[model samples]
Target: MAHASTAAAEDSCPLLLGKNKLPRHREADTSEGRVVERIADFQGPGGIIDLVYSAVFTRGIEKVKQECLLEAGELPLVPRNFDCWLCSTELLSLLMRGSALGNVGAHTAEGSPNTTWDGHNTIGLLSKSEKDKGVPIADALKNPLTPVWILHGGDHFTVAWCSAATPAEPGSKFLLHHWNGLPPGGPRLADLEITAIKGAISHGTSPSKFYKPEPGEIEEVVQADPDDKTDFPGQYRKWRYEVMLAFDRPDLQGEQRPVDALPEPKFQQEDPRYQRPGAWRCCLCYDRRFKTMDFSLVPADSPDWCQKCSRSRKECGWSLWIPFAELPPKRQAWCMSQYAKKIEPLLWTKWPEAEILEVSGRELPDC
Candidate 1:
């Protein structure tokens, strides 16, 4: 009798098909119009922006949420970059601008429950948990504008969503993972070489024997960038190698709060003591790197010294554009060391023909 009843109960239970199956007694509704059954759940660090291999979305109780599988290999087809960034923005905007209440943050400074940066909840972007203090996991992924979190690794990049109140699987429309660039991925090392060759030609320099020349090739000394190419068609002659290094964390997405937990700094007034005149500053931070000028000394129309924030550029050897944005904290410091910084650009230039050396970084989800 007990065996018959057990068999009947098993038959009555919903068919087990997808990867995610909640524990018994949770009573998840799978019927249409009810809570739709999500394929999987978001499992990873809360505050860091994770590079998802794939993702999905559904509605939750009060607000929408997302369900992401950080490690799942096969995922619903979607553009890699856009999907992730959209998900991040949606969730963050809700937390920052919306009136939704919950325990996104651990506690407010006054000991009351607070969900965001003190006083201002929407001033910044996502902060990685390892770098911030007591920020909820959901906030980091919602708004990537302030943090500009990127998911880079594998074939596709992605962004994820999280909810602090419900530690369970996400179920909302906030999940997305759109791909950008080439579906096959970005330029290869050989592609960069061809770019160098083209640049050399544009500079009116004959091809040199720096890289292995063809069977019937002539050698000539010339100054040229390694990424340019003379003949666009000849670019295919060079062997291309894809250099995919680990970036960000597989289980991390974006940070929910400011790293310092302090209000973002505000400049009260221009200090006359250290006054700088006629300098073009970055629109965002107004960092003094773009172009510093002195109208008092130099003509306004004269060439101005504009320094860009190294963080914005891609890292390359001759470019010497190794910015902290591309590297982790420890590696960033180490890269800036006198020895490493001095040698890195040289290594890139002298060894243009050499294969790219793979650097190990935090492995992120494969979106």
Candidate 2:
């Protein structure tokens, strides 16, 4: 993986590898509007990056509902009762519409229609013919100018965009972005490419439909055991579909820039405990170790008192009264070293380029 701070780290596996180095810190661009505000930074209170998915999913659902209302004059309320899962078709449709409305940005080829169904193509069931037919889509994605949205039938979505071709590898500059974390192998763009081609070769223009859950299946879906290891009650099992959305036009209105300049994550700045620039741990409780310490920053003039240690002093008979700023440099270093050791596995597993000391503990000297 490139680094955790550069792009949203949705899952444990690394997603994209850009040709250009991503900036370590960036300020939020407030002028671009709320969409930018909503997802420009990667904060981790929830441990999952779902803002992009939530935004796209909600917009797709609303678009479907609006189209239904317009065509039928009365919307069927029954379908809304179940949790909605968007098929590749619906997501592509929403992306196209969002681009047109200037809410989403995409690349498009010159002379291509202002809008075209060509933005989306689905490969069904990884058949031989399907693979052959998907060759063009796969080829188009190789160009850095092309941006495509990939949807996996197994309840996942991700995007791929090309980075500026480098001198070393000019022809293949694809980079992927996924909101959800990836499995062990990292972003599977190559796997998707192979699957797309196989699916196209096998299915060859056959009539197909993205699966939709029935209203009756909603209860079972809601009540299903998350750990059951089986497909959810209404989930589709046999078929896998991949949708590709092309970014042909350079004039599209959206956040088309590379994700280098996102604002600092909120957790680093706002988390009351464990302020940035330092790594801390509860000194009183021998067993209380912190990979990243959890404690609020007190003003420089505030009295030195370890509230956490004080709260349980009767039980542990220890009081860690040293404030963060007053800690001896040697002690501060010790804390940071401990934090680095604790986070070593994560760095090796998910964030290889992580500045271990900067991310895990503190970087500043005690006042």
Candidate 3:
């Protein structure tokens, strides 16, 4: 069963089949649409994004936000971004207006109920007993957006349709494992997205048509950002959650919201009031050393100052990544003391030259 227009309805768009046919449940019965029936197979480093790599939409949703592609988010495709100040709707306002990452405190507040940060639905991939609050599963799949919800489970990802599509297989709401970024059924939602973009371009559709951009248009569109509203990656650091799972749990939010998590806590901020000894030290540097940032995403060569957040270790409270292996022996010892219980063992067990960071993050999803 199928309903609603293709997110990008025209056959020129990749969301549709060869003849502009929507991905109806019956299509899975054929050879062409069977790709949607496969599963994602991911393993090891770089997470799901690594396993399902594609150059078209490189950098995952990040590139999409930083560039233009008006048709990127149409009927079946849900269009939204948190840094609207950077890019509004379909325009490519990628110029770093200010700090690369700096924004109001409640950024993650932009999290939506039924959709993942990238517009995926978790229904079929979630456990029956899972208590995570979100839009109803069955309805999420049959959205005004894409009929297919390229969902992400903990370890792996799945490309699934609504109940009307077919059997979810016993003991689960999805079908088999992901196909390792293969044709038809892709390994990650990003892969599927890029595939669609490629299909659209192959038809000779002008690239500029989809990601149209106009000078000064971004500032005009995002001018009236309401203080209380949010978009993708809202309150991300505050909530200590992944972008995919970050916003769906708005009810979990409370008074802990930082009155102003931005402005980089400069020497002028009241919260980080000037003090003799404290004022001289860089809190951002201290935090990165103590593992304040999400180490999983942090780069070994991360700079002392963050271009996104527009802050440096000089701030009262900020963080970044560490090249633990590259740090001087004394510096390495200090960082180890912070996450001692987790990585200290590496000093003893692993090879002296091993890339110890391989252990900090999540395990690969089993197929």
Q: What's the number of clashes in each of the models?
A: 51, 32, 27
What number of backbone clashes does candidate 3 have, counting pairs of residues 3 or more apart or in separate chains? 27
Give lDDT for model 1. 0.26
Alpha-carbon deviation at 242 in model 2, angstroms: 30
**Residue 351: error of model 2 in Å?**
31
Q: What TM-score would candidate 2 get against the native?
A: 0.24
| Per-residue lDDT over 1-367 for candidate 2, one digit per residue giving the tens place of the 0 to 100 score | 1111112221112233242433322212221233345443535553133443443453455655565344223333222323653333333333333211221111223422222322322211111112222211222222222333342323333343224221222132222222223444333333111111111111112222222222111101111123321543212121111111121234434443244643211111122342322222222333333533643433233234345556432333221222223333333333333333332211111112122222223321110
lDDT of 1 by residue, 60-80 (tens): 222323221221211222224
- List, residue by residue over 104-151, the lDDT tens digit for candidate 3: 111123432322212322222221111122222223322313233333
Worst 10-residue lDDT window, candidate 1? 197-206
Give the lDDT of residue 200 in candidate 2. 15
lDDT of each: 0.26, 0.27, 0.25
Predicted model with the maximum lDDT: 2
